[model samples]
Target: MPRLLSLALPALLAALLAGCSGLPSRSTKAEKSVYQGESFAAEETFSRLFDANVEDTCEAARRALLSQGYVISKAESGVVRGAKHFQPAGEVHVEIAFNIVCVGDGPKQQIATAYVSAQQDRYALKKSNQAASLGVSALGSISVPLSSSDDSLVKVASETIPAGEFYDRFFTLMQRMLRENTASR
Candidate 1:
């Protein structure tokens, strides 16, 4: 009976290990092809046509961003860049950066296309503990661990904002700004 029990325990352990080996691990494996050709579609998610010149289109974009409390990083004749920060949680911070480029569609400069892209960066507050070390002439160097912790915001994720109502709302705001400018003039 003792010999049989010992042999059965070993067999059970081996079978369990073999079964686990056949299962998938927790780590994720990336697909061989990251590009699924979804970007080849003729969608107007990243760009919009305006009936204004390049300068006017870019001006509208700048105004739209400024109206939404975005800090303009760069403002050129045909390009605009802005960023806005958000804190939705106690330790989570988010920043959305906007980049807009306007180009004339024809030499007549009557029509323009504004290409816009937004990137979202997420940050989390991370706390780390530090140990203190002291060196004294009377004794050798000694290290002591203190309860001190350092907190810092670490970037957790960054990705371009997907195409959808986000861009639609921005374009709508730009259109409104352009109309308002026209009315004011």
Candidate 2:
């Protein structure tokens, strides 16, 4: 029994040590410094300093959202907020929120960053029934059955768009808005 126990312990220890190698190991100081050379998780900010003033930037942002069918909700204090609700299908509905904040003085220029967040929801049809009582029916006092349906939006998921392409497209559209807004005046 002692001999078998001694033989099995080493094999079990060896197998356990082998499993640890599969995990990521700590890097050496030099190797770690190499990785730190570049930023990995830095937030992608899409802000551009425009030649126009702050008020014009805000107006351009508002007009950009409006042109894209977004309903402007708030426009004050160098911040322009807009939202758009659109239906893609019979039951799927999506709402996108556009928040553009401008910073800097009106005399020189301003920089604005637009953030977009989207939420998707699906509507479900629910059927319900009700019993109604009628004092005087054609024949006698009777009861009637009624059916109704209602839709409720179920939010499945939501997230902030972290892609650069989306922000680039938005900024490009905003640029066009600024140009047009200035052109009109």
Compare the candidates by TM-score and give the number of the best one: 1
lDDT, candidate 2, 5-60, per-residue tens: 99999999999999987877666333555447545444665566666777787787
Number of backbone collisions per candidate, in order?
Answer: 0, 0
lDDT for model 2: 0.69
What is the Cα-based lDDT of residue 154 in candidate 1? 99
**What value of lDDT does candidate 1 attain over all alpha carbons?**
0.91
The 10 consecutive residues of candidate 1 with the worst lDDT sum are 28-37
Q: Cα deviation in Å at residue 182, candidate 2? A: 2.9
Overall lDDT per candidate, in order of appearance:
0.91, 0.69
Model 2: CA > 4 A from native: 1-43, 105-146
RMSD of each: 4.8, 9.9
Q: Model 1 segments beyond 4 Å from truth? A: 1-32, 133-147
lDDT tens readout by residue for model 1, 1-185: 99999999999999999998977765755454446635756674799999899988999999999999999999997999999999999999999999999999977989999999999999999999977765575777665655678999999999888788999999999999998887898
